[model samples]
Target: MPDARTTAFDIDLYHIDAAYLAWKSGYNAPSAFELFTRGTPFRGGYMLTAGLEPAAEFIGNFRFTREQLAWLRTIKPYEDEFFEMLGAFRFTGDVYAMAEGEIAFAHQPLLRVEASFVQGMLLEAGLLRALGIGTLIATKSARIRTTVGNCSYADFGFRRAHEPIWATRSAYIGGTDSTSYVEAAHRFNIPSSGTIPHAIVQAYPDELTAFREIARLMPKYMLLLDTYDVDQGIDNAITAAKEEAANGSGHTLMAVRIDSGDLAAWARLVKSRLVTAGMGDVKVLVSGDLDEFKAQDLLATGAPIDGFGVGGNLAVGLGSIESDYIGGVIGAVYKLSWIDLPGDDDDRMKIAGSKSTWPGKKAVYRFGDFDHDLVTLDHELAPDGGRPLLHPWMKEGTLLHSHPSLTEIRERAMSNLAAMPTWLKALAPEQDYDVRFSDELVALRDRIVAEHK
Candidate 1:
């Protein structure tokens, strides 16, 4: 345990201050409760469950450093005995979750963790942090991917997301063809795509010379064609490409990117120009502030762009979103849903206004052809045709399954989404997909409510 341990993102350290304060106030709860809800209102009908492996990794390796324990003694509330207890903390729990790429509906628990109340409580924040950002990016990425059909796009949102690495990974799983983050490229083995910035074109004595030099070094690179003048850059690139072909070099690229201005109109212009300039094989790529909404709009109007580079809209999702019918940052959360005790089994729930959650250890099951979903109690088996959604990810504190590769995950997303109704796929759909409560689940809710009343 180096000091760097605190610098990283782990619930043990990330929630250390909160955990200490809770201990001081005797803020111990006997059971974990689901404030009973899930889903981002503005993000449409469903979310993609992601970051489970990373979340599991954190819980498995979490530890409190000596310095952390020593500092705890100085923090106002935590007792020495508490620090002693902290010295032996480990997350011994059972976790069930929707697979990483699974589509989740509202009020369905995407993940459930059964640990002692305190341990589970401390995990809420970090788990939410991971799933919130990961799911948001994945959902956002999926929108862009589904909107474009076969047209390609890259996750160029690294510069925009709060967690650059995680966001890129989420976007990849969400469905981007590639990323501009070089480190993530190797880490995930995804294609890394980038090209000369406007700065390179601006610095050159002539755009042609810059392209020529770059082509010599990286012959397959896509050229940035809007730095000086979109048309001029294209002309220079044509001359450079001819030169490369003559010399048996720089012969691979068939595309140039336009980063600014009216992208839809520009995409059409670039396509026409590339065809007339004797480089008809060359394609047009557009980058800038693009999202699924904007891309969807462009495709609707028949933009001739070959690819899109989505940045801010994909990277930095609703940063502080807090509504169901409206939009902003994703509203993903984590909560304890069930607890087992000697001679007793309880399903805990919160009835807080506007934040109420379904009570119990619950499981989600999907209905016909991905049209609707049912949220049911975990113990009460649904004998109906509903297919169980949550699978065992961890048991006895050990990871029980291997995650699919990014490629496979993306394929799952594409395959499943294809079955989704067209109306539900709309950018801002007029109607939400149906998410029903099982009869048993509803009956349990009624019984619990009657008891309180």
Candidate 2:
């Protein structure tokens, strides 16, 4: 792999080719692009907007390095002038986006870019990647949080994540209390959480030894059960906790993790044993292929599960078969909305079948407790008591304000979720949200369609 320090070449080759062609033709006029998805993921009513920080970072750092330019030269015989243009390329754009952790709906522009045509085209791939994965994981995490309800949840999906750092950050934005990925924890300032793995128990000689040693070494630690036998593991954990208390080590047993077999039944058994031993304060955290649906089912069983450690389902975007949530991709697309030329500004859109896009620069206005949203031309007036979801984040490629801390973003997410109607927050939301276009927007679309025809 190439050095990770430089992000110059983190773009599709077609964008470069198109930009080169545009440079040759002198067609780099002012343009606008909007990033949006047509539907919600997870069969849910809404999506949590995330990744704006990373996307803004990408735009701010847009530039070509000498090494990257040299590497590009070897790919094909390109003119030196084109390379010089690339070396001097910068994203002198204006960006409008929803704040990280805000709730969004279908057809809303999560992000909008206004820049030169070449600059906007070059941003497509990276913007999609950042916003897509970040939003997907955040939405999934929000659903999990809803199901778990007041329970401490940790992201334990580093091994299953396509990109561990991004997954960890997105999970935190969507309401996870902590993450198991140490690098992400340190980098993003997220709380790190985990329990002793099965390997640790095997490495020690026996499960009991592992539990005892970990309890002795750490002030607070979670013991991993089911390394050998679930019953024996529980007994060992209890003994270790009791010994730690008697020895006055000041150590405390935080929780016990059960990673195998019928988790609900095992959680019940573990909780029962802990209560009987007068260690009822010991929390129960369960893992192993846990998803929102499974977590909901487990909680419904009246099991005394104190927390959840979700892995693949939380990080990998594997749509729940039970909930019929679409997975694998968030389906966010960046499309041209308008272009400005000499003495003429033209609204643009794709007219292809179901892929047709709305024309012109737009703004989404929410009315009456998010009861409905209206998409209208950017120049349109907002109705009384309306709130605009998108706000200026960047001007001429510079941030307008400092990015919010992760804790702030997580709190915003929880607040947004709390304000949503109950039906929309349901595990399987079947009702369609009212997202309509203004009368003027509809007229413009019709006129544009007629002109195309």
Minimal lDDT window, size 10, model 1? 1-10
Candidate 2's residue-wise lDDT over 213-265, tens digit each? 98899998889899898889899999999998899999999899999899989
Residue 84 in candidate 1, Cα distance off native in Å: 1.1
Task: Provide the clashing-pair count of each candidate structure.
Answer: 7, 0
Off by over 4 Å in 2: 1-4, 321-324, 343-345
Would you list the C-alpha lDDT of every candidate in the order shown? Answer: 0.73, 0.88
Model 1: per-residue lDDT, tens digit, 1-453?
112243223554546665666566665445543322355545576677677756765666566678866766675465678777677777777777777777876777877877667677767766777677777778877777888888888888787778887788888888888999987898888898877788887787988889987777775778998887887877788778878778976356667999988888877877787788677777788887776667777888888878889887788764222223343356766655555555654765556756767778888888788867888787776758888887777776778876678888877777777877877776667777888887888887777767777
Measured against the true structure, the TM-scores of the candidates, in listed sequence, are 0.90, 0.95
- Residue 385, model 1: lDDT of 83
